[model samples]
Target: MPEYSEKVMEHFKSPKNVGEIAGADGVGEVGNPVCGDMMKFTIKVKDDRLEDVKFLTFGCGAAIAVSSMVAEMAKGMTLDEAMKLTNKDVAKALDGLPGNKMHCSNLGADALHKAIEDYRQKQAS
Candidate 1:
């Protein structure tokens, strides 16, 4: 197993925003079959900002920590701001992820971006 940073372990042990948002404005789901990791992010928006963010992730400690960190970062961010969020940022927020588990950060960012996309699509309709 790869060594994890203290922040990663802390988030994995007690992830914030761990559940789904009821009647969420947007939801995104992604999976990496090669790594058997799955993630779903749900969000609520208000005035073009992410009013709330939550996630349910099934994967290793790194993936869970990534999801938790993503949720913490995206909440209250403007849609444009959240859209710019990147895997690099997530990994940095967690201090860093081992090279092999870095993909977890990618998944987290993708999931949040997709959720924002979903919300935008709804608005456009």
Candidate 2:
């Protein structure tokens, strides 16, 4: 049986940053067709700082937990700092995830990085 951390369960039940930003500075979508996990993250940045982060995910419980945690971690961070976010950090934030769910952690980090990259592209254009 997979034992889920209490923190992960809590975050999933009452997810943070669950909505969408009307005019997001960046938006990123990623999915693993093999596992059928999909997540879309949107960020609003101001003064190079991550003002807000939101996500919509279609996956298992682990995916929801990871997405919620990522949103909470990204807010108030600078774009560079947010970019540095890793799957390990997210797993730690959740008090640790099951070994089988490790990919969910990676998915969250990838989505956030993609969103940051989108923001950078917008700035460049």
Which candidate number has the best lDDT? 1
Q: Tell me how far the alpha carbon of residue 111 in candidate 2 is from the true structure, in angstroms, after superposition.
A: 0.5
Q: What is the Å distance of residue 125 in model 1 from its true position?
A: 1.0
Model 2 residue 101 CA deviation in Å: 0.5
RMSD each, Å: 0.9, 1.1
Clashes of 1: 0
Instruction: Report clash pairs, candidate 2.
Output: none
The sequence of per-residue lDDT tens digits that candidate 2 reaches over residues 52-107 is: 99999998889999999999999999989999999999999999999988999999
Clashing residue pairs in candidate 1 (N, C-alpha, C atoms within 3 angstroms): none
- List, residue by residue over 1-125, the lDDT tens digit for candidate 1: 78999999999999999999999999999996576799999999999999999999999999999999999999999999999999999999999999999988999999999999998999899
Stretches of candidate 1 off by over 4 Å are 32-34
lDDT, model 2, position 4 = 92
